[model samples]
Target: MPADQQRTDLLPADALQGKQLGLSVSESPDLDRLGLLDTHFRMTLGELARTVIIAGGSLFYGGHLQPGGITNFLIEELQRYGRRDRPLKVCLAWTVHRAMTQDQIAEQKDILGLFGEIHFLSPVGDRLDGPVNEATIDDPPAEERSRALTGLRTFMTANTDARIVIGGKRAGFQGSMPGIFEEVLFSLERKQPLYLAGGFGGAALDVIRKMRPEYAEWFPPAHDMPVPDDRFLTALERIEEIVSAVQWDGFENGLSEDENRLLSASYRPSEIAALVGKGMGRLLV
Candidate 1:
């Protein structure tokens, strides 16, 4: 049976609730704002009973290509609070833009199990079809990964009654969000609250503000500088530090050519630029 089918009790106070705020990234400096990130972090962790779902392919699956240190932080945090007890379910929806070996799949499994179930929505690759241990692998045919976004959007909308948290894997996912903005609007119309996890910038935010004025208040005010005490910002900074350091640091010492290719492909400059902006700042301060 699906996990959703199981009988569930009213969520505890610390569990996730309906109608919460989301974090949109714009500039690298925005991540330094202690005021904004802090509040978002508390809301994320405090609302334990809520389901926190993140989209995008890079953040969760990047470890297959390189030592994506950010993955470890999320695994550690999820392990710290054992999802069975906490109200949170961190869903990592991955697109199989790159191929993986069975051994690679095993590693992903281990990391995913630390939290709730890892659900893989990879377009069916011949390589990834067999006995993977951890994630519930949904291997669609070629080109299906892109199409699956609709199914993904449906899952988000249908599951709104539960204390639901939603985010994307990286900035690119947010860039793509406008393409699926209608789905988002429908979900929000149904009162499904989502967290815009990837970093945002002023220009991109202006686009968003114009796109959805009703939800404009949901975003934190545009700050020329960051707020110092934000927990979510702190977390974001820590994450950026880890990912950035690994990107250029000595972590690539042992990776294969394929692994290196995956790493290189993950950082699509055009996509990232379009998502955040040509002069957009990173989540890292």
Candidate 2:
């Protein structure tokens, strides 16, 4: 069907209507060298978010809050094109907000609260008391912090109808597993519709590399990509090993083999958004 006709057919019964779509995005520090820049990353995400918003769905955000950061960038885009009914919902784990000053915490809440509801999630164990601040509270052990992040992602994945994963750092992350990796794994286990736009590269591309090496032809050579530490590599391999037990050839995210192939290769925002929209459209939801 033609694009205009597809939109017309969607009408009031749009598959995207009222859906809580999760977004997992960030940059690989070396993303610019891979042919996609920070500007490119935001634009692609903005376009994807816009598409979902226009169809009456909302985007779930779980990112760090800072001046002119990626989270604020998405807010600005939503301000330009989003409706009041489709406000952006942001989730913050304890570790994320704890790193901020009290003033920054208030500032972030004021800003994001204007867009949509803000979820302040607690750590998996040992809840802290007092105002959220970096100085007042001691940082949890690396292991506990890792579990907190996983708890947050698990909550986000469980709540959202589907998930879209983009760029992310694969190493030196605070979690036992990389953030995006945990999200993807949980999303797969829950059988949520997963859209991995690996063309932009990062952990998402690394996932494609591990699960579908043939798709690497669509990405730049990984020779210059940062080599992860043994711990990170070990974590990644173990996660992959666990996910592989499902005994599937690929992620069963409501897309066919050919569609997923393109989803892993295409860097264009319109193409990526279209494919995601296509996959979500196929869902029984």
Candidate 3:
């Protein structure tokens, strides 16, 4: 059997036994204020990566072709602890754009060398420029961009066991909250565990406000300029509507066809690590 087929053949329980953890974060500057770049967050994420590796699992992260950010830091940490015997199994989902020059592509390839599995989600055809940050640059029409975004979400969802989203700006125009929201919706529908860390307040905070309003106090004050409740609500409702309108077949990943599973929740980093550790133990035993 082919390698990809062999991977997809594993039962959901067996896949969970591998303890794969996905980390999703915003590239917005607010992440810095949230202390996501600090030693504590790095140490925590590194420790979690180490724990997952030691348990014979893998780590996955997705992002644009940039060098510095939470993704780079995570890559560094994983490389530090990566062992040849166990090999720090890592996967990267890189968003490629038409604007990328040959040099840029080479740089991306060099960076991807650290990962065990690499997946590229690009536009359907050559366009003038790529989607800038969260918005399109000016070339690709809206419909084409939409298709690319959908494909990227589907690919990421099918390839990971669980997801962790952190420090997203509330305003979609300011960051990639729209895409992240869609990913969260997909993961929730697939009955995959989701950890939303909104300590700095952004899209994650907005999600918390909508999904679990009672936990309002748990989130910190909005680090960036505060987005008004009315404005945030409007965007949230729009995303929710999009999610509801879609009829997901739940066949993207090779898990059981049972769609009734409850597999999403909000939690802190420590709590997330603990839950992952517990799940790994149970599945391995």
- Once superposed on the true structure, which residue ranges of model 2 sit more than 4 Å away at CA? 1-14, 125-135, 138-140, 224-226, 248-250
* Model 1 lDDT at residue 90: 30
Q: lDDT for every model?
A: 0.32, 0.73, 0.50
Q: How close is candidate 3 to the true structure, as a TM-score?
A: 0.62
- For model 1, the superposed segments whose C-alpha errors exceed 4 Å read 1-71, 82-94, 122-145, 160-183, 189-191, 194-208, 211-285
For model 3, the superposed segments whose C-alpha errors exceed 4 Å read: 1-19, 27-44, 84-97, 122-143, 172-177, 220-235, 238-272, 279-285
Candidate 1 lDDT over residue span 1-285, tens digit each = 432222122223332223222222222223343234534433333222122321111111211123533344445555654544322223223443224456875676665663533334432212223444444444645345444444444444444331111222223332223323424343444443222222222322223333333333445675554443343334334433543444322112233333222222222222222222111111110
The window of 10 residues in a row where model 2 has the poorest summed lDDT is 4-13
Model 3 lDDT per residue over 1-285, tens place: 752343223223233445566665554335565555545445556555655655566666655556766556656765676543332332222234544555665665566465443454555222223233443243555565556666666666776777666545455432223656666776767766555555535565556556555555554555556645464566577545544665432222322212111112222345434444444444333
Task: Write the residue-wise lDDT of candidate 2 on 1-285 in tens digits.
Answer: 774444223313346676889998877655776667777787888788777877778788787777788788877777786476536877777777676678877777677655665666778523344445448445767876787788788778877888898888867788877778877777767767678888778888877777778876766575755667675577568657756776543357667778788888777777788778767777734
Could you tell me every candidate's TM-score relative to the true structure?
A: 0.39, 0.84, 0.62
Which number leads on TM-score?
A: 2
Score residue 235 of candidate 2 by CA lDDT: 57
Which candidate number has the best lDDT? 2
Clashes of each: 28, 0, 0
After TM-score superposition, the amount by which residue 236's alpha carbon in candidate 1 deviates from its true location, in angstroms, is 26
Cand. 1 Cα-lDDT: 0.32
Order of models, best TM-score first: 2, 3, 1
| Order of candidate numbers by lDDT, starting with the best | 2, 3, 1
